[model samples]
Target: MDRATWDRVQVLLGQFVYRSHQMRYAGELIHCGHCGSPITGETKTKKNKKTGGDKQYVYYRCARYNDEDHPRIRMTEAEIDEQILALFDRMRVEDEEFRNTFREQLRRATNWDLGTETKNED
Candidate 1:
């Protein structure tokens, strides 16, 4: 909620920007759920209402849904992550290089910008 907190979030999220294997998705956040066209990017915010008040999560929803012209289904963050992870789990084991890259990328993301922020007692 303060400047220091925002700065930390920015830095942590920044680390995730330039990576290869971590990006298992074939399309950017801009891509539409139907036509596969580029749309607006995901928006980030602090989810203070959650149980842990986790600040790390960044969420995106298609803006086209709000448009009267384009009516489409909205998806959840958990759903999206599940789909990507499922795809990765099913990735061809014959490709040793790809599997290795996936492993390495997962390791990097797990360790990246990790730090403890205090839990809100109120």
Candidate 2:
């Protein structure tokens, strides 16, 4: 395959594997609060000779870590999951206007247009 085709194939394969891993670890769904980029997870396994098994370590890292100015930011999967859960617990959903705004933002992010009527009504 040409370099472009090979690159595209590699990207597609990586996406498939990442999505599969994400489904298995749902609570790890997170984006970078700093740059709005999706976060990716990495796993490392080491052999444990005594137990005849592998020790696994998982990390959730920001995707925009290419810049040296931005220090590498990462968290253990468990830590990030727990922190997210805690955030949800403390979050308040009582603001109607905020909820509506957030819903509209989500719709826009998905490229769904809000009709003029809806805007006028708002």
Candidate 3:
């Protein structure tokens, strides 16, 4: 196959694989606090009577949620996002020395030198 056709085939295959396993935070990002199991995402569609449409919602819950004596706690994606944001907010650095160290480490990790760069006004 030609280069363009091969690239298109690769892109289509990637999209198919992504759609087949569309859970965003299923494996590594979160775990169940109560059961210590990985959290999995699910999508649910609810029919809207007033609007005559279907509203889809994503939720995350423990993989063992179906097991007996589970906590039965399922959180929507929005709730998980809010919790993550709150966590980041709590992780803000107050000490100047620690902040500087963190900034340097982040710069090194990302291989970017923001301090030495100048912005163009034009």
Tens digit of lDDT per residue, candidate 2, span 34-100?
8877777766666657898865555566777676766577665335434533443455779978766
List residue ranges in candidate 1 displaced over 4 A. 1-30, 42-57, 69-79, 95-122
Candidate 3 lDDT score at position 101: 64
RMSD of 1: 11.2
Runs off by more than 4 Å, candidate 2: 1-28, 93-122
- Each model's RMSD to truth, in Å? 11.2, 16.8, 15.5
Best by TM-score: 3
lDDT of 2 at 6: 40
**lDDT by candidate, in order shown:** 0.45, 0.47, 0.54
What is the Å distance of residue 98 in model 3 from its true position?
13
How do the residues 1-122 of candidate 1 rate in per-residue lDDT, one tens digit apiece? 35543443343334454332232222343467666555443433356686755444323445455766675554333344445445556657788987887645643443442232222222
Better candidate by lDDT, 1 or 3: 3
Off by over 4 Å in 3: 1-23, 94-122
Cα error, residue 60 of model 1, in Å, equals 1.6
Better of 1 and 2 by lDDT: 2
Q: In every candidate, how many clashes are there?
A: 1, 0, 0
Worst 10-residue lDDT window, candidate 2: 113-122
